[model samples]
Target: MARIKLSCERGRSIELDTARTALGCIDFQADFVLPEGRAGALGLPIEVLLAALPAAQRALSAAREAGMFVFFTRECYAPDLSDLNAFRRQYDVAIGSPGPLGRFLVKGERGTEVIADMRPRDGEPVIDKAGFSAFHQTTLDTVLRVRGIDTLLLMGYTTQCCVASTLRQAVDLGYACILLADACAAYDPADHEATVRVMYSEGDNFGWVSDSQRLADASQSIEH
Candidate 1:
């Protein structure tokens, strides 16, 4: 078992276990992160997306130094749109044509690729998910099981959507998750705040919330 550390805030705390924990970055792809990317086209706050970048990078560095596993998820849909749900298709129409990004979330498109700064390093796993939840229609569960990752430290785009959805599923699947609140954002600040408040609730109904710096400090104590 990995050594466990506790992070407490506002009368709540989450345990962080080094060996059993992994940093799961959800949907940090160009479509969502870049200022001129798909998210901007949809009128989602590109600033909100960009704001989490530095914190995410810091967390990744800390996890790497601590010998923790890191996984990046990309929201990819089939080129033929077979994999897109009604909401996504509708979103595509709302965002107008995909422009140079190749029709929104279609796989193999530049917009669908992970952003340059957030790219996965050697040995890091990149999981392609077709829906809001990384666990939905993806091999994330299998990967985590095989690697023995009992806990997940989450970060990435659209806090109220993909991030929240994955966090909920992760809890149900019996994995302890800590949402890096400062490392995740949404199109709306209110949405982001509400999601964090729910996760950071007294009883920890879903998981816990912490900023990247706190998580990094906690990971640093593991003595890699």
Candidate 2:
């Protein structure tokens, strides 16, 4: 298998097997990242999330070019809200509420779709998840395992929430994970930085932390 060395935090690095790696884009949907979507409707800061779009796009392109399996995750619930958990229902009042872009976080709604700037390509799996962790009650794990993917390159909106949750779960599931820091964002810059620090802390106890530029550069250097 062809391999590439990815430089990680704490002066560490890891080998990425192009054939065994997959790029997992988490919750880059309109509800989370777009200015005219739920976040904006709720008066949350969408600019920070939008700022990551360029890096995310670059990483997505690089992953596709390198022949790595690419998958995207969108956080949404059933139209009837039957799939929504009690905890989420109690806290996220906007889940089924109408917003600028249809019903917020409702399946089949425009707000639940991945943003146009970094839409998934044809044949790339787009997993619809009801929870922050993409693996929770989703087919993401099975899809990855079926493809023989053992490593994940993860990036997307809300570093402190969906991205962090998915990365932690991926670690627990025994997948070698790398987080693309610059390709993710949170409403609060402090929260984003905090998540990045924790990811690389404890000698990268959870997973390796990296940036989208480095990932893109390395992927581009791979020989086809």
Candidate 3:
């Protein structure tokens, strides 16, 4: 297996073995990305989140071409709110409330599904998580381990929230994480920038922060 090195912030870089790496598309659901979804209804700028779609799509395609494991995650709770935590319930009144796209963040709802453009293909795992971190009470870690995936390239909506939480957890669980900066978005550009800065700070403590283009180029180089 050829190892591809990706440059990171603060003069850092990380190497990945494509065969042991997976692409994690986190919380790219309609509720977060679409104008008619929960985020837009809550006054979050969906357009800002939508901006990352092109880069995400490009990374998804590159990962597929490189034969890297691909997986997606959605932040949704059961219809009855069985999986909803007390903190989340109190903090966000819209967790299970009705909205334009069915109950907000509820499973089996249109808003909970991944958007059309970034929908997972056949055999790709779609993990439904109730919490911010994909590994929390979900099979994400197990799925990765079962596939022998030790490195992850994470991309998706809300860099400061779900993406950051998942990246921290992935690092704690011993996975070498590379966050595709351009492939993620936050409601505020500053928030996105802050997350990226933190990710690469402290000697790349949380994870390496890189963009989709660099990843694609590195993977393509390895393929040749």
Candidate 2, superposed: residue stretches over 4 Å from native: none
- The lDDT values for all models are 0.82, 0.88, 0.89
- Superposition error at 87 for model 2 (Å): 1.7
Which candidate has the highest TM-score of all? 2
The top-ranked prediction according to lDDT is 3
The reply for model 1, stretches above 4 Å from the true place, is: 1-6, 41-43, 86-97
Off by over 4 Å in 3: none
lDDT of 3 by residue, 1-224 (tens): 66778876667788888889999999899988788887888888889988899999999998887889999999999888988998877888878889889988899999899999998999999998989999999888889998899999999988999999999999899998989999999999999999988975766678787888888887788645
* Number of colliding residue pairs in each model: 0, 0, 0
| Residues 35-84 of candidate 1: C-alpha lDDT, one tens digit per residue | 67777766767887788889999988988877889999988877777777
- lDDT, residue 8, model 3: 69
Better of 2 and 3 by lDDT: 3
**Cα lDDT over the full model 3:** 0.89
Error of 1 at 170 (Å): 0.8
TM, every model: 0.91, 0.96, 0.95
Greater-TM-score candidate between 1 and 2: 2
